[model samples]
Target chain A: MKPLMESERFVRLAAPILVGAFLIGGWELACRHWQVPVFLFPKPSDIARSLMNDAPTLLGALWVTMRITFQAFLCAVVLGTLIAFLFVQSRFLEISLFPYAVLLQVTPVVAVAPLIIILVKNTQAALTVCATLVALFPMISNTTIGLRSVDQGLANLFRMNRAGRTATLLRLRIPSALPFFFAGLRISSGLALIGAVVAEFVAGTGGRGSGLAYEILQSGFQLDIPRMFAALFLIAFAGVSLFLLMAWLSKLALGGWHESEVAREA
Target chain B: MLALNHEEAVTSHEATASPSRKPSIVDVLSANKIYADGTEALAPVDLSIAPGEFLTLIGPSGCGKSTLLKLVANLIDPTDGRLQWWRGGFDQVGGEGRRLAFVFQDATLMPWARISSNVSLPLDLAGVPSAQSKPRVAEALKRVGLEGFENRYPRQLSGGMRMRVSIARALVTNPDLLLMDEPFGALDEFTRNRLDSDLLALWWERKLTCVFVTHSIYEAVFLSTRVVVMAARPGRIYRVMEIDEPQPRGEAFRNSARFADLCRQLSAWLADASLPSPVRASP
Candidate 1:
């Protein structure tokens, strides 16, 4: 009754701007007063200057990484949803195939990156496949659980109405699986970014056309800590932004029905 | 033999008075359900609910009341006895007799859907276009007194409100028969009483046949035209009592002496149903 969203008003408008300014001011002061080595931790002002100087290069690297992450993510979503549907439909398939999915998830992507790069001649496709493998498992597992988790009473009600199998799957199971699907998507977005970076790391895709991992490697070779910090910042920012994007998508899809979204807005 | 009393007699007489009428046979018959573990969930039972009469099956837990309801709904098959419907002159497979709707005790609404969409689900499955079904959904919501809560999710609603949505969903299709397995057994005293009155109002308005299952004697007495008491351990019917009350019964009727007397009779029958089988004494 008081207002639709006083809490959101406070958090969105006041909290972030204030906290961000405070951290920057504190860092500037510490750099100015304390005799901290610039190579170890560059001053916020220096880092800003370096970021401005290397804006074009950093932006290009960001674009490359983003393209890989997005392509991998799209593939993961399609393949994961298909596999989850398959698992939900047949116990035999799930029994035979689910352990392999679990094996893929548990095995470290870094350890397999070299082998993946060796097998796939194309560098970009190899990176994409590595990222897809990393991001695919959670979507399958979460969505499968969600699809199978319908209330038995409701299922019986559907049966009593003589609902066909396709109708039940489309109207009941998929919609029921949406929240879980989004949860897996949110987790996989971050993992997708990590997957891309790690695959690039192992493949050593170094050059002007290479991603941020190559930039970090280049900066390391030239003893350019500020540039390296700038590249690292870009990676972190990309991961956070992609995660927020997934969260926003989740909100759009399930905001009206879910309590999680409702609580956030409140 | 089942004899018609005054109310049923007048109703059946009026029904037969119409010309163009055909003799109605029992739609479902001689249903028996035994689980795979050799537990006879329902003993060989016979129940013949009329086309548009309200019949409540009241009993203790594990008495196969729900099992009987499920059998008639065709959710599960009877192990022994044949459950044949009179398909004579009807185009459909099992007769054009009636479609079945079930309402559970838990108000098992899909939490991901809005109340209006949830209520319209039966129509949605029956290939009714959304545009055509919207007005019916609105009417059903209005009937349940949930007119303004169409967009609210299940989590935002109170327990009674959710149950109303469930009832509205069941009634939206104008189904021929409603199989309710203790739909209001989860509500509080005040909410349950309100829903009881509302349900009677709905039944009177629609005149659909109902087979309600409940453990509460008072609820069975207040809502049902006839309460069929069932006993456990290879469950079978213990007794059946007809409530001599008018339709659209009010809360005042629930407090009436007549209502109390019926409740007492149902309670005694239920008590007898719950008791262990007795051995003959050497007299």
Candidate 2:
């Protein structure tokens, strides 16, 4: 039998979407009927109208936030991959340096934001560094696990074939590390957006092309509740989109060789 | 087919009537293996494999058949004794020209690589350019009936197909000796039987020296020119049986009385191997 087409599959996939729509619709109707205060949870319709009204400003903030997030995410991925390679290659270094990585992960970006701004002397670089620090640990840990997670039997097979360390690392270990590396990437993408926003919030850039955080702060100060909700929606959308993009990239890279991707296809 | 023809022509030209002038001797002399926890994995053992011979070591689990294979492969050093290879009056423990490839019970394929690349691994390690290794990989895959699966990944293949890919990988190096440690043990019976027959056919065609370790008597008899029966409790050889059979052994041979006789002999030897040593039993 022929399989269901993409449209049909999407329709089948829309059950949760429809439920979510119904819930939002019900909330909007209840708020309007009860004349609830707009400051405390504006209606979806009101938010959508505010989004359209301030489209240019909101889009500009989104572009700024996205740029920071992308730059930071890229830095995190490169730095994390390098650290992971080091961690896998040397046990002494891993033991000594891993706790410092954990310190970076556990220390809130808010606490570090002012310090980073003071040290870097550039607002954009400070924000990027904050986001990178926040997003790097998962990649380091996951990629390290992936590198070390190769099958022992396969290692022996390579050894018996007289494969040198470089060949083993390049041909066997790196490919094995890809899935875990991407998994970490998916998680860190969202963290990067959150980190960018938090860093902007703490840094107090004073409206010099700040991100969604500044927009939200500006609307809160101006008592524009619907506009604030609109900015929040944009941030949420960006976070979800970045996460999905990473997920898609992972599937594309690993789908040809991994069982998880094959199951998704089925 | 072209490579097989070349190998056959070479073998026929070198096939002398007398056995005195064998091309080389791969020897394991009084080898001993002892684990750190005081477990003797393998006792003193002396064995020799002739060039172009197919030998199977049959025993129960933990009989050190695999240890013996690893010792020969130089993957692990024996606690005592020596392994020697003699080629043209020169003796060496291991050298560059002696390319030895090992296939494990697990397919042990690199999960990330395409089948063609995985099969090309040995040659890659040997510094053969990818261009030079491509045809050898294709021929190896063709020999193992995996011709159309060059682009597929290991995770995409069935268990049997993955094992075939491992076999293709072992053959891709064109090594003089192939060592397999229960390579088909994990496969289902039907797949195992089919792989056994395919392996025998490939062995006959390539004239490559093979040292296979298996737990199955029938499989050992069906594939080997000689069977080395190993006993446990500080593993040592119990018996060596030579099968006076020709190439392309089929299902018909498996059903024959002669095949049953060999299987029974190996089984009895294995049983004897498992029992406590009589020298240690006296009060």
Candidate 3:
């Protein structure tokens, strides 16, 4: 049983990497056989070469985009959680204000970006606002569900003890909400990155503060396809890293008790 | 059709008891429950739980046993009538020896908290600092025979162990009145019997007033001073049988012929309660 468990763990890690290698190998061979133009679709070798050559510029832009994503994610977590608490505290407030939260989520960030830029004055703050709006809904919805999903028995126990609102929220609701809140974090991290990039595209601002999206736009105008692919790769890498980071943090927080994070024998 | 008026039964149980007694901890007076959809969950029953008495409510499903327990815990208000806590109103509850604690059937420990934290929840909610509650939590765990498992999570424990932790949480509050809703109904017979004995011992040692709900007639007879058999379809009490057994009952009592006789009597009462009610049929 112990050996079988170890082998199962090995396969879980190996399977995804094996599939990735096969797909990348197929793409490289297909590009060479077709003699595709680099501008149309750069070969894997060309993308890798450009990635190394333009490392400094691409890395700086990567840093800018990531900073915006991090800031936006923090703001969303704080504000979204506050709103969720308010919603759970009063059904009337949730009924009246929830539609507006939906409206904010449904409206496209790209379409809202130009309007926000006009009003906010500062370009960075406007981009963060747009990203924050994009990332806010999951935290609010998931945390609200978590807080309200307390066990009926536990709630009765608390009431039997005459627990006050603050005591119940801190001791009972908040701890129960951890798993869902972490789930929201995983989703919001990715959305924050997406929001930042889309806002950068709509703004099209170029300067010391330009993000990877601006670099991609610049490369497109110049027909620097290999460089554009490199920028795209960096963006993909950042998004994957953010997601993994959130997952790791979730495990660290909930691994001991939560069913989702705890390892189970097959 | 077999419904006995609450007054008649209430008097019988009290009349048999010793004359010198403390005020009854809880008086559930003519309290009935009708859900929002108009299902008559309970049909206005009266019960007075005396101090240090182990009273059990037993019947088939939908007999309002759990609903009645909830009403006793004040977890839900009666749709009509009222309840008195220690001869006073609800507001006077939770004062000194007047505290109440509840044990749910599911052993509803917060999965995210350690066993120690779970046990200490009532104390924490009451604003008792960690310094004061730490020893109390340890004592409660020891009382439930779970001293070394304090740092473990709820998921790490077995079903019986989890139930013990739930019992420990109730004990940590040092409550005078303990209400349990089919707490061991889900455990295997062996584990349930073990827990039943442990619970009986706890109740004896603490002199705690307890109202327990369960579906098992044997369990009702073994652990209760008086078993209240109830019927469904406009849930109401069918009969009340006093065990007339000695205190601190154990394996010897379980193996005794007297225990078997009492169980048979309660089992027959339970079957009668589960039959379609003649009162409901006429209506």
lDDT of each: 0.82, 0.84, 0.87
Ranking by lDDT: 3, 2, 1
Q: Is the docking of candidate 2 incorrect, acceptable, medium or high quality?
A: medium
TM-score of each: 0.90, 0.90, 0.89
Model 2 residue B90 CA deviation (Å) reads: 12
lDDT of 2: 0.84
Proportion of true contacts reproduced by candidate 1 = 0.75
**What are the per-residue Cα lDDT tens digits for candidate 2 across B93-178?**
23222346688888988777889988888777778777788888999999999999999888879999999999998888666678
Q: Which tens-of-lDDT digit does each residue in B177-222 have in candidate 1?
A: 6789889888898899889888888887676668898877788888
Instruction: Tell me the tens digit of each residue's lDDT in model 3 across B92-136.
Output: 433232267888989999998999999988888777888988998
Clashing pairs in 1: none
Give the residue spans of candidate 3 off by over 4 A: A1-26, A29-35, B1-22, B35-37, B87-98, B278-283
lDDT (Cα, tens digit) per residue for candidate 2, span A1-266: 55544556667668778898999999999999999889887899999999999999999989988999999999989999999999998999999999999998999889888989999987899999999988888889999998998888988877766678998898889888888888999988888898999998887676657788899999999989999999999999999899879989988998777876765543
RMSD to native, candidate 1:
4.9
**Candidate 3 residue B138 C-alpha distance from true site, Å:** 1.4
Considering only the true interface residues, what is the Cα RMSD of candidate 1 after superposition?
A: 1.5
